[model samples]
Target: MNNAPVRTVSDAKRDFYSHHTRPINSIYRRVVDELMVEMHLLSVNVDFAYDPIYALGIVTTFDRFMVGYEPEADKASIFNALCRSIHSTPEHYRGDAEAIKAAVSGMSLDDLKGQFEHLGEGGEGLRGTLAAIAHREKFKYSRPFGIGLYTLVEAVTPPEALKEKEAVETLFKDLASRLNISPDKLQKDVELYRSNMEKFAQAQEVMKDMLAADRKKREERKKAAEAVAEGITEPVAAAPEAGESADSPD
Candidate 1:
């Protein structure tokens, strides 16, 4: 028998917490914890092979969910910890995501769609990976995979094109068909991802407005205090005696 040590989900959680000792903001704590568990479970599964798309999904998910995370530096620390927990490198994931982005940088929506359609011919980057996924008999379809696909679609499609909901839906449905993936599930996952992104943006805007308001209040208080101090030091005209006006003789 081999002497390799066995790893468990608890071990992964412990490792991550140790590295990221700072408390996560309450708003994002659940998301971060769940993501850690999910990654750990997937990493330990024999059937789950790491892929660049999955890496992109993880990175994208973390960045988007962790927007406005306090102690902003902890964001990187948390990500690094999560990757190490799974015995993976953070840089590898980031680099792969960048590579995929670069590969599809200038392609139009149709060009990217064609890449998915004829998967075996798109070469060694995302195209090759898509082909591999398509050929795998028991491909493990996960939320991350859906997110990764969404990321790719967003990269190629123009901002204006994305607004055409029917067109976008048809593109995803067609891609799902070509990949032999579940059309409904893929569509739903992408829709949820987009929805969450919009919510996050709205939440950030609210937070920004609140912070600005708080800062303004503090500044106003500071100005008022300065005015009070100045008033105390400066001489003031005596109040008008009884009913006599200040303009009257006195």
Candidate 2:
């Protein structure tokens, strides 16, 4: 019988919380837990191989979803816990993501696209990785992989170009074809990711408004207390309404 320990999802979850120690805000607790579990499962899969793209996906996903996480310092703790839970190093993931970003930085859309098509000599770094994935018939495709592709496309395309739905669709379609991946699935996954990002942005805006309102109330109460201390009989002037707002911890 094998003597090696068998790791389960619960084990990974336990490890994560142990590392984090501090409580995750209720709003983001589920997101952190689910991400940990997903990473654990993928890491344990026999066919799963860590790659720069996957690293970029993990980094991007965490950064995006964990925006406005309270005690800002805890974000690093949380991410470290996440990577450790999967028996991986956070630095490796971050370094790879940075390298990939640097590779495509200042590259035109066409030049970036060309990296996926040809697997010739001098094909190294991101180009080699993409070509290998394209040629591999049994390559495993996951949601994170799709997100990685989306991240790559977004990195190369101009900000204004992304607003044009048709242009974005055509780019993804062409990429899907080159990679021999299902166009529908890739496109759908990217779209879903984009939709979730939009929802997160809306939620953050709502949270910011709520925090601003709470801060205003607190300031008003403080002024009232000061007035009472001064023995003033008249009502204190209303606090001026300010347009500035603080980020919510949620």
Candidate 3:
């Protein structure tokens, strides 16, 4: 069969003027369209499958869409809202609602750390990722700053910190246990530092480009305004020497 029709949430309402004669088709369309729209609204560039339950299909679609769409920065607040909404749903819709959650639960500490470290350079990619995560659409890593800094420090820390020295050994042991990885392994994996460093470089390059572009625009505008004020058709020539007269004809 051809694809289902796509409709926004606004179009899916039951009203006096309209009734859902083809509830299945209408529901399918509404769900699919909402998912698609939510992706854009949430800044999720990743493509996802569109599957709707046979019953309470509209609600199912929205609940699932909201899972990954929850803003990363405000996860605690939005999650509270999500829990409340999920609890309020009818029992029949609960199962389908829970299914949407399953999709996001796959995000783990490691994955989050990787992405956070990758995007924390505050460059174009990181900025874009943050924008999406802020909207609750993309997967934003939670511990980028912490992980990145830890990796950097561990890379260069003195041997005393790593050896069994009483004062520093305690800190090393704690870090190892908390990270759930061995201290030696963490120190050896210097690539993580390189990766974050590269991200920082890329961000710097993008910023340079942006600044250059802005400068070019400002220069152009200044020239244009000068040209208008001077009643010149093109850019003005260099000014004559202080003592030399323009009318003297060099």
Candidate 4:
């Protein structure tokens, strides 16, 4: 019987490995190595962070500023940001894997930064790479929690308006401009911190109002019970008190 050559197991394996797996894995490893080098350089030069987290050590310091280090919190943050960056690397390359691998091979951390120098103008590794850079540059790895901005807000905010985020963010943007950091550098950090701070402040206001309402309700209940025990049949809102503070809370 005449027949065409059958595609055997070996043929399938060769096809899969050559066309798909080998090239991809080779490129992937090269990109990862380059990323590691870039991360290392930035850690040392910009962040002053010494030990790479992926590298084994007794401990590693991740604080951008020597003064801002916290043993309990910032250490964990260092580990988290490192791991997050690694997980995000593939996404940074995305569909243009071959092109990105080539581009990244010769690029360093500073080169990566240059790619995204202008706002809304960025290349492959914009968010992932810049986020790592921002974490390091912001005096520690935690972006979006601006202690510097918070202090400034506290200074300018009225005692009654501490929870207001919009005013504080407006003030922060103005102050940040004075620092000369670009909007690209500040966007993720400021926006994330702004949202968290706003929600926190709003939640606090809600709590304050709830507590005040509970206290008022309890006091009224006590007064009503007392009046019922006595012979007084007066309604609770019998008449408005003269010159009562209209500014008083509900």
Candidate 2's residue-wise lDDT over 1-250, tens digit each? 7667768999998888778898888878888887898888888776777778888888999999888777789999999999988788789889999898888998888889888776644378888888777777677677888888789889988899988988888888998888788989888988899999999999999877877897799999998889888888476555554653444232
Q: Which candidate gets the maximum TM-score versus the true structure?
A: 2
What stretches of model 1 exceed 4 Å from their correct place?
A: 1-6, 120-122, 212-250
Per-model TM against the reference: 0.81, 0.82, 0.25, 0.24
Ranking by TM-score: 2, 1, 3, 4
* lDDT score of residue 190 within candidate 3: 31
Quality of model 1 by C-alpha lDDT: 0.84
lDDT of 1 by residue, 118-158 (tens): 77554577778888888777777778878988898888887
Clashes of 3: 3
What 10-residue stretch in candidate 3 is worst by lDDT?
Answer: 48-57
Q: lDDT order of candidates, best first? A: 1, 2, 4, 3
Error of 4 at 239 (Å): 78
Task: Mark the regions of model 3 whose C-alpha exceeds 4 Å error after superposition.
Answer: 1-142, 145-174, 178-193, 234-250
**lDDT at 15, model 1:** 93
- For all candidates in order, the CA lDDT equals 0.84, 0.84, 0.39, 0.40
RMSD per candidate (Å) reads 7.1, 10.4, 19.4, 22.6
